[model samples]
Target: MTAEIDRRSILQVIGIGGGIAFLAGCGAGRTEPAQTEGTSAGISFRDQQGRTITFERPVTSVVTIPMPAASLLVAVDGGADHLAAMHNASWVAMRDGILGTMFPQALELPHEIATQDFTPNVESVRALNPDVVIQWSDAQLVAPLENAGLKVIGLVNNGKQEDVDAWIAMFSAMLGKPERATEIKDHSDRELAEVKELAAGRSGPGPSILYFNRFVGGLKAAAAKTYNDFYIKLIGGSNPATGEDPLPGTGMVGLDVEQVLSWDPEVILLGNFDGAMPQDVYDDPVWKNVAAVRSRRVYKVPLGGYRWDPPGQESPLMWHWLGDIAFPQEQSGLRGKTTDYYRMLYNYRPTNADLDRILWTEQNRQSADYQQFNAG
Candidate 1:
C-alpha cells in the first residue's frame, strides 16, 4: 500500500468541484509518464453524458464506485485483477470472488477502499492513488473525486439499455478492450434477438406480475425498465402498471388499488422477502375480487443470493429465472449450456458450479404454488 501525502495537494484535488482528471492511452509497448499537466496520451471516447473522456492506456490502478458498474469493467477486460478498489464493500470481498469464479480470467483484486457509497474515503482514496474511478450514475460522488484530482467516468448499469451500452463502451474505450466489450454487447443483443423472434408472431394473454418486496416501509413494486422490467420484458410478462413512466435511477412504478383493478392481469408474481409472500391478498375481500386472485394465477419469485434483497447486476441469477419462465425446454441445466453459449459467443468458458450457483439458488425459487385469490 502506497501512502500518499495528506498535504495541500490532496486537499487541492478535492477543493474543485466537477473537474475530473482524464488520461490518454500511449499505445502498447511504449512506457510513458503517468501524469502530464493537462491530459494523458491515448484514445478518446464520448461518455453517456456526451462528454469526451480519454484514457492513456488500459487503466490498471482502478477503483469501481457502484456495484452495477463493476460488471461492465469485468465484461471488458479481465477486470478483477485490475481493480485496486471498489465502493460496494459490503459483499465485494465475499460474493464477488464466487461470481468471478464463473469467469476464468476475472481474478480476485484486493480492495484499497471500503464503504458501500464511497463517501467516507477521500483520504483513503488519495492514499491508494488509483489511476481511474468508475461510477454508475452518481454525479454528486463524481464532483468530490474530480476535486481530488482523479479521473472519474460514469457508467449506467441500472438495467436500462442505453446505460448498459454506454457504460460497456466507456469501459472498452478506457481499457483498450473494444473487442471484449463488443463481444459482451453482441451476446446481450443476440439473446434479445432470440427473445424477439420467439415473441414476434405470437401474442398470448400477458401474465400479470407484481414485484412487492420489503422496503424500509412496507412492500413496494419495482419500477419500470428497472432491472425488474428488463427481466419481465425478457420473459414476455406484463407489469400491472405498464403505461406509467419509469422513475430514473430508482426505476420505481407506483401503483394503487384502482390501477390494479383496471389492469386485472391474470397472474400475480411477488418477490419472496423474508420467506414471506402476501398470501392474505387472497383472503382480502377487495383483492379477491381482482382477476388474478379470482383466476388462481399467482406465483412467487425465488429470493436468494445475498438474501433480503432484490436481484440486479450482482446476480446473473435472473437470466435462469427468466429462462425458466420464458422457455421451459431451455431450463434443464440451461446455465450449464450458458457456459457453451458464452464460449461460442465470448470465447470464454464458465464453470458448472458457476452456472448452478447462479441458477438454483433460493432467490430463484418461490413458494411451490400461487395462493389463488378465488374472489368470485
Candidate 2:
C-alpha cells in the first residue's frame, strides 16, 4: 500500500507552485462593480464563515483563479468568454481540448498567467479589468483581492450537496439566471430522488465503491462524501467509507490499504484515468485477491465529460455513463445518442459533428495527461 498524499502535495498536483508560480503586476482596481437591475432573481448565501453575500447579476469579465472553478463557470455559461486570464495555460492549449475551437479567445490570454496559483503576473489580471474573480476558500489571499475592490466568489469543488447547491445557486442568482439555477436544482433533485427510489429495498449490504487514484507506489481510494463518492451514490452505488470525514464538493475521504482490504468491495469502479484500466489492475497479482477482481466486477470509469469533471446539471449524462458501464443492457445507444439527453438536460444539442468531435478527442486522451480533466 502507498502512503496517502498530504495537503501540500495535493496543492502541487493542482499546480500552485514552481513554474506555474504567480506573476507580478499592479494590484490597483481597474473596473468598477455594477449592480443588476432587479432583485427578484438574486440569491443570498452565507459563506463558510456565515457572512451574508448577495448575487444580483451574472459575473462578467470573470477571472478563473483555479481550475475547478473555471470548469464550473464554463458549465454555467461562456465563462471562458469572460475569463480575462487563468492560472493554468495547459487548460487552454489545443492539445488539451479544454479551450477547443469554439473558445479561441481563451488561448490568447497572457502567458504569465497559468494554473491556479496567485503567483501569476498581477498586472495581467489588473489589465483585463474583470468584474469578478473566482478562487477557492483561501481567505487570507481572497481578502486582498476583495481589498483591491474586486468581487470575489469562492467555489467549492469537493462535491458535497450543501456546497454544490450553494455554489450553483449563488452563481446562477448572481448571474441573473434564475432559470439556470432552477434547472440545476431540479436536475440534482431528480437524480437524488431516482437514486433513492432505485436503492429502496434492494436488500443485502450495499455494493461498495472506491475511487482509486495514484499515490505513493500504488493507489489510494478517496473517502465517502467526495465528488467521486457522491457520483457513485448518485447512480445508486454505495461507498463503504460512509463514516469517514467529509470532503466538500467531492465528498471524498482518504482510504488506507488496511481499510480497503477490510471493506473488500464487491464492485470496483476504477477511475484509471491516466490510461490505467481495470484489466491492468486485475491482471496484476496484488489486486487478484480483492473480491471485485476475482468476481470480474471491476470496471473502468469513462474519462469523457461525465467522469473527470463535475457533471453539474449535466448529471443526466452521468446516468448515461453509469448505465453503459454498470448496466450495459440499458445502454440503448445513449452514449452515442447525444440529442435526447442533451435536449432534456441542457436544452441544447451540439451538431452531430460536435458530438463526433468531442468523442474523438476523448479517444486520444493519453496524448496529454491534463486533457481529460481540462475537457469540460
Q: Cα RMSD (Å) between model 1 and the true structure?
A: 11.3
Candidate 2: give its CA RMSD in angstroms: 11.3
Error of 1 at 278 (Å): 10
**Model 1 spans with C-alpha error above 4 angstroms:** 1-41, 89-97, 100-120, 157-159, 212-217, 243-250, 253-320, 326-333, 341-353, 361-376
TM-score of each: 0.65, 0.65
lDDT of 1 by residue, 42-145 (tens): 55654433356665555776777665445445545653566666655423423533444444343345454545445536677777788787754356666777
lDDT (Cα, 0-100) at 68 in candidate 2: 42
Candidate 1 matches the true fold with a TM-score of 0.65
Clashes of 1: 24
Which segments of candidate 2 are over 4 A away from where they belong?
1-58, 87-124, 215-218, 243-259, 272-275, 305-311, 323-338, 341-376
Residue 196 of candidate 2: its Cα lDDT?
54
